[model samples]
Target: MRELKYLNKYLFKYKWHFLLGTIFVIISNIFQIIPAMLVRDAINYVVDNLNIYQSLGQSATQQKFFTVVAFGIMVFAGLIVLMAFLRGVFLYFVRQTLIVMSRLIEYDLKNEIFEHYQSLPLSFYRRNNTGDLMNRISEDVSRVRMYLGPAIMYGLTLITLFMMLIPFMFHKSATLSWYALSPMPFLALSIFYVNNIVERRSEKIQEHQSRLSTFVQEAFSGIRVLKSFNREAQSMEKFDRELDDYKKQSLKLTKIQSMFYPVIMALIGVSTILTVYAGSMEVINGNLKLGVIAEFIMYVNILTWPVTSLGWTSSLVQRAEASQKRINEFLKTKTNIVSEKDLVREINGKVEFKNVTFIYPDSGIKALKDISFTIAPGESLAIIGTTGSGKSTVSSLVSRLYDTRGGEVLIDDLPIADYNLTSLRKQIGYVPQDVFLFSDTVANNIAFGTVDSDQSKIEQAAKDADVYHNIMEFAAGFETRVGERGITLSGGQKQRVSIARAIVREPKILILDDALSAVDTKTENNILNSMKRIMRGRTTIIISHRVSSAKLANKIIVLVDGSIVEQGTHESLIGREGVYKDLYEKQVLQEAEEKTS
Candidate 1:
């Protein structure tokens, strides 16, 4: 019942269709019961009218009696066939309405979940795996639809038939109806017992399935790394372990589910036996007519099917309940970042971090502490640091990827949190250290940042990134498809294309986080030369380890241990004999050694 609360809106949205479908179910069942009554009437007519030959030894009287009985039998048979046909027609409409409604709901639910997924903060994705989320949206949603469609449909059928048949059964013979229904209490208890076991096992099965899916997705994504390290055997062993676990869990659930049928069949079998034996005794003792006995059997048979179907319907309900719980929990997650009521529509490219501190949610370790800096509009500032010195974290904070723990991050004299997330992000273009290019044409990937951009602009951006010539060398040129993660291109090519993607946006604030690490020295110099003209009116923040890259900035900051240990021009920093000087000398020596070798 708790799990079903999440589905209430969809159910209510389509309540009219469900109501009409339920009416069809009731009407169909009403038609379905008429044939049994007709059978009993025909049998009684045959038995009573055939006694004409015994009473009057006239052939003419016997012929008339036989003719009347035959005519009555034909009429009953015709009505039975007509009733069966009508029942089938109503059942068809029932399925068309309710089953189709389930599909409609499924479509809407999938879109809602996907939209919610898009709106969630980045921290939520970090804590959750891709495969588990996929399973929840795909498999769990389908299970819920099954519950809404077939489970509810048949459940209503059983209820309506049970209510209608009880009084009718008593009408034929009260004593016989009691005997036939003796096993019902035990059947209900057994269904209750099985349902509990099924629900628990179903939850475990779904959990194991999510783990298995995550393992496969991660393995396939990292296949190149595994093969390079020659660890295929180790990976295969791990996969086999996961597979075995999944199989064991699935079989355990199957074993429990398989118990449903035989138990139900046994209970229903007992009821049938009692009905026949006790009914036969009533006929012989003259307490009940044979026709009434036959009618009683028909009623028990009608009840038999609904009782037996209880197992299947209960299983569907239990599984759906388990799945709904998982989905509802996911939907209830609160986004860590949100826009304030006073939303700023734009920024003037001036950025500041005032006594900012940040801790990663997963590690709970401070990535930055008391960091303060300012970049004036149209000015270029370079950040140089060793690994883990919070260089990239500074860039992420500028974009408001993660909210600051302690101080204010402002853009254009307003706190960053005061701006709408989308509007704020639209003003900044960031290129991360790990460049990701989608599987698409070079033109499309370059234009990804700016939707519906013209071809001329895309070409100009590619030329600015200094990859236009290399792109032309390909067979399809800009139309060539870059495979997954741009695997078809070299590392330098991927990096340049990613830079072009950022450039095409023509942002007010451009962040390059080790964006030139993969290119050669000459190419890097060329890219920097091109960027100088482009960076004239744009605020640029370059985070790099290379001295050549950092030296081009108007001002340089050297960070060590999440704090700025030095801030000056390259020449000033070199004269001070600080960390930046040491880095410059080392790189100079390494380049000289490489040339000599």
Candidate 2:
């Protein structure tokens, strides 16, 4: 209930719909109670007139009386039918307003969660799994909607019916009313007990559901690996265990829920029996009419369904509360990276890392340690390193994907934080080491960074990345779908397409973090030649391990264990007997050996 308080804003947002729905509920209940009253009057009239009919038997006067009585009964029947029809009509209106409002709120909440997810920093993603994030927006939101729609509808109906029926029953016969309502307090206590258990089980069920979803998602995403390793049986056994656990939890909840209706029915049965027994005694004592007893029974029957539905409504509220709490946890998370300035600046691409140090927040691994470098506008710098030597971290800082933990990262001589975040990122073309492409056409993937890029630009960028002929060889050429994460394309083609995506943007600062690793030497050289033309007046940072790529840069820096050990021109680095020189010699020897073989 406390967690559900978060939905107050949404409730207020659709207050008009809620108000109209409430009005409909009231009207429906009014129509609902009128039928019982009509039945009461019809019965009383019929019972009272019985003796008069007997007295006038076998005469024209008797026939006239019978005709009048028959007509009166028909009129009561018609009015009862009319009341039922009107109740149904108002119920329809109630669903249209209340249920539709719930759907609208669901839509808004999902979008809000999605937008917040997008705004969160990369570290936040590292801290959370994809399946859990997906479940919060989808499954949890659906649960909250149940509370907003059906629970609210039924709960209101119960209150309205109770308010109308209870007073009417008391006004007619207080003793009969008390007998009929005697079971209500016990019913409430039973529901209270069940609700607590339901809430606890609902939370457990949701948590287990998230784990199951994550397991399935990961299994499907890595199906190829599973098949290759021949671990299908193991995976199936694990899935079975999760499924069994889910079943047990669900059954426990279902068992409790299953008891609810019977208990309510039992209570209702007691109320009915009590009303009949008490009313019979009053009638025998000549204190109450048979018609009043019938009316009280009708009232009790009217309340039966609403009272029975209390358990269901309570369960929905508990589930919704659990889900909303999960949703609020993520919504309350404040992103560490935010734009300090709203002014969009034109980037000249002078990137500088001033004694920067950064640690991965999730792992607490120091990726960069007191690293400093400058790439002047239109100048190309190559960072060469062994695996895990912080080459990629430099590129990440230049793009402001992360903020420095210790020192400052600057663009155009101003702190990168001072620039509008969107403007700064839009001007930098960053191709990461592990490339990712959407399940889309090759042309679309290439043109993704630039929303309005023409086909000519896409083709030109593809040619520049040395992947144009490869794409042309496909049956659909540039229009071919790349499948999930560009699975349809080869590794080299995917990397090249990623490069074309960045190229299409025509960003001022271009950082290729091992973007050409999958391409052959000949293809790499051709792409480098094209890049030389593109890099003439743009700042470029080429992060790679191969000397062939680094030799083309105007300056080269060698990294070792998260620190830069050497920095010089390519020719100077080759002349010196250092880490860079050794790497260059090793690569040259490997290329020669490959050619000989």
Candidate 3:
């Protein structure tokens, strides 16, 4: 019951519905008890008539006796039918109000969790898998619904029945009721034990399910690699291993549940036998009437279903408690980055990194260390670096994808943290090395960053990215669907589409991290030439390994091992005997050698 406390907010939201549904539940239970009482009354009437018939002997006509018995039975049956009908009506509304409320709450919870997931920083996604989060939001949420809806409703029914039946039973025959209910305390203890085991097993089952979902998602996403490597059998074997674990856990839970039924029924069986034996002895000793004994038996029968349901309801409660705890743990996670109060909402694209340092959340090694640089508004700077030289890290910081640990990332001379997160991100356009495109139309993919981008704007961005001609070649042009992650398109096509997406936003800062690496030098040169107008009055940062690309920038910086080693114009760097000079000479020689070959 304490586990249900988390649902207080939702319950309060739908308080009126619950109140009406509770009234229905109470009325239905009350009506249900009437039929049993009617049965006792019917039996008593038959007994009284029998005694009168015995007294009348020869004077009582056969038809008259038959008429009296039929009349009494008919009256009782009519009352029973009327009560049952009333109960059904109330039960219908109980389901309508309570069950529907649960669904509404489920809808709210699912949307809330998804919104929170979106609000979380990128580091959170890096540490968690999609499948595990999916399982929590789907399966775990459904489990909580069971507790909120059916469990609460049925638990209330059982409690109401107990309150009504017990006192009546004691009034009829306290001795018999005492003897019959002696097994209840033991039954309760058993239920307690069962619930504990159920809670533990339910958690394990959910965990296994999460692991299985993750495995399948990863395998399917990487199916191309598995096929190329000819590792189908290996993948199948791993999947089978996880499947076997899931099967074993499921069976263990079933085995525990199976043991519950017999233990419960057997105790109930013992109580029934004792009540009958004691009542018969009392009748023989003239301490109780036969009709009273029959009524008590009917009451015991009514108790059977609710008592049996105790095991099931407890199981629902235990599982829900476990799932709620898991949901709470996820909701408690604090985002690593948070925007400050009263922050600026506009950006001028004057970017500066003042002695910044950053390390990944999990990794102890620093990604960028004591780095410092500034790019004025409307200026383009190219960063050339070897693998892991912190080139991409600089682009990430400009967009505030990550926050600096040691120093400040400033936009328009204010710390980046002093701007609203939404405003800052809206001002910068970032294109990463690996581009992700949804399974949507080409036009939609290009216009993804903006809400109201029209056809002309999409085409203009596409033309600037040097992809408009290629798109026109497609069967349906911009309307054609790109497959998952733009898999149907070539690497160069995907990169161009991604560039178009960023350009359509008309952002103040554009950061391209190896974005043009997939295209040929001719296409790269053409795209850069076309981007001149778009890049005007906006800061642009190009991170690339190619000297051909870097030579066109207003300024160029060479990085090695997380620090800048050289900074100058291409001609000035070529004049020096340093890293930039070596890189330039190698690329020029490689091109000439390739042409000769």
Candidate 4:
């Protein structure tokens, strides 16, 4: 019942259509049950009261009996057909409305979840699985469709039929009605027990379903890697184990269901027998007529269907509740990054780190400690360091992917947190170490962030990134679909496409986090020259491990152990004979040895 609260608003919003359909059901069932009652009256009239048949001047007693029975049969058949037609008519309209409601709810829920994803911190995404996130938005939203359709109407039908059957049963014999109600308490208890089991089993199924989705997604994504390393068979064995676990869990749930269903049927069968025996005694003792006994039997059969619906509905409600629990858990979690209200900032690429300190969540010590720096407009700077020297962390702060712990990262002389997130991101283009491409055209991939951009702009960006000629050589040219994550493209091509996407944004602050590492020397030089030409009046921060790449910057900052150790032009850094110079000599000697060989 608590799970229903989330759906109440939508139910009320579409109440008129539901009420109309319900009215049709009520009318149809009323006409449908009348013939059953009339059968007993007609039979009793011919057997016990022949005066009415004689006064009508039909025929002798035997002929009148056949005539009356034939009339009753015709009436019953017509009413049954009419009821069936009404059921079909209402079902069509009701299902149509439900389909619309389900689609609307699905769309709104997906948008809300996507908005939440956009607001969450990078730390959240780093910690969570991508496949789980996908399941939350796609599969979970779809689960609500059944709730709006069969589950809801079946519950309503069960409740209404239960209320109506009591009067019909008591009309035939009060003692029979009381006896039928006797088995209800046990039925309710068993339903409650099975429902509890269903909840646990359903939760297990959902958990394994998410794991299966994640494994399949990750394995398919890295199929090329596994094949190249000759680990395809090993990967398949792991997948087979997961599939077997899923199958075992599914069978356990099915076994529980199979047991619960028979228990319900057995309890129902007991009541049916008792009802039949009690009604038959009433007829034999002359307290009830034979025709009335027939009506009682019909009512008992009708009661049986509602009982089955109750048990079946209980199981469905339990499964839906389990799914609701997972969905609600996702909805209740708050994002670490919150947007400022109605905030926007015009950017000119003056970036400052003011007494900043930051620590990753669930980690000890700060990633950046008491760090402060300032970069003027149009200046190009390079950050160089060994792995985990706070170089990437500092770049992430500049892009406002995360907030600082102690102080602030200011852009355009304003605190970054004060600016609208979208506006701020629009002005700062960032390409991380791992490039992501959608399954779309090469032109669409390049012009992703720009709304309503034409093909010329995409072509220009591709040319700037030195990838235009390669795209032209493809069979479909610019319209060639980049396979999932651009799997069909080479690593260098993927990196170039990612760079082209950022360059097309025309950002005021451009960040390249080892984005050119996949390309050769000639291609990297061409892209560097393109940036130099177009980056006027904008700040550019390049992070790289290669000394050749850092040499293009006007000034270089070398980080060691989360602190800046050297900051100067390449010529000045080499003259100092420090860590930067030592790294430079090492690379130069390696290149010289390769050339001599």
Question: Which candidate gets the maximum TM-score versus the true structure?
Answer: 2
> How does residue 269 of candidate 1 score in lDDT?
78
| Structural similarity to truth (TM-score) of each candidate | 0.88, 0.93, 0.90, 0.88
Choose the strongest candidate by lDDT: 2
C-alpha lDDT score of every prediction, in listed order = 0.87, 0.90, 0.85, 0.76
Ranking by TM-score: 2, 3, 1, 4
The whole-model C-alpha lDDT of candidate 1 against the native structure comes to 0.87
Q: Over the stretch 1-597, how does candidate 1's per-residue lDDT look in tens digits?
A: 689788889989999879998999899999988888888788777777767646766678777877777888899999989999999999999999899889989999999899899888778888898878988899899999989999989898899998888888887778898999999878867876887787777778767777787788788888899899999899889989988988898898899879887987887778878888888899899887667666766776777667656766887887789889999988898776887855857667998989988888877878787988888999999999988988998898888788998999988888888888888888888888999999999999999967768999899989999999999999999999999999899999999999998888999999999999999888998899999987889999999988889877889998887888899888899998789999999999998987788
Clashing pairs in 1: none
Model 2: lowest-lDDT 10 consecutive positions: 187-196
- Model 3: per-residue Cα lDDT over 1-597, one tens digit each: 565677899999999788988888899988888887888788778877887777767764856987878988999999999999999999999999888888889998888788888788878888888767887799889999998899878888889889988998888788889878777767766866776686678679978887898899888999999999999999999999999999999998998878777878887877888788878888888887666666676677677767766767888887888888777777778776778754856677788888888887766568788878889999989999888898988987887778887889888998888788888888888888989999999999998978989999999999999999999999999999999899889999999999999999999999989989899878988998987888888899989998887866788999888888899888888898999889888988997887788
Predicted structure 2: lDDT? 0.90
Which stretches in model 2 have alpha-carbon errors above 4 Å?
Answer: 191-219, 233-257
Spell out the clash pairs found in candidate 4.
none
Q: How much RMSD separates candidate 2 from the native structure? A: 2.4
Clashes of each: 0, 0, 0, 0
Give the 10-residue window scoring lowest on summed lDDT in candidate 3.
Answer: 54-63
Reference-based TM-score, model 2: 0.93
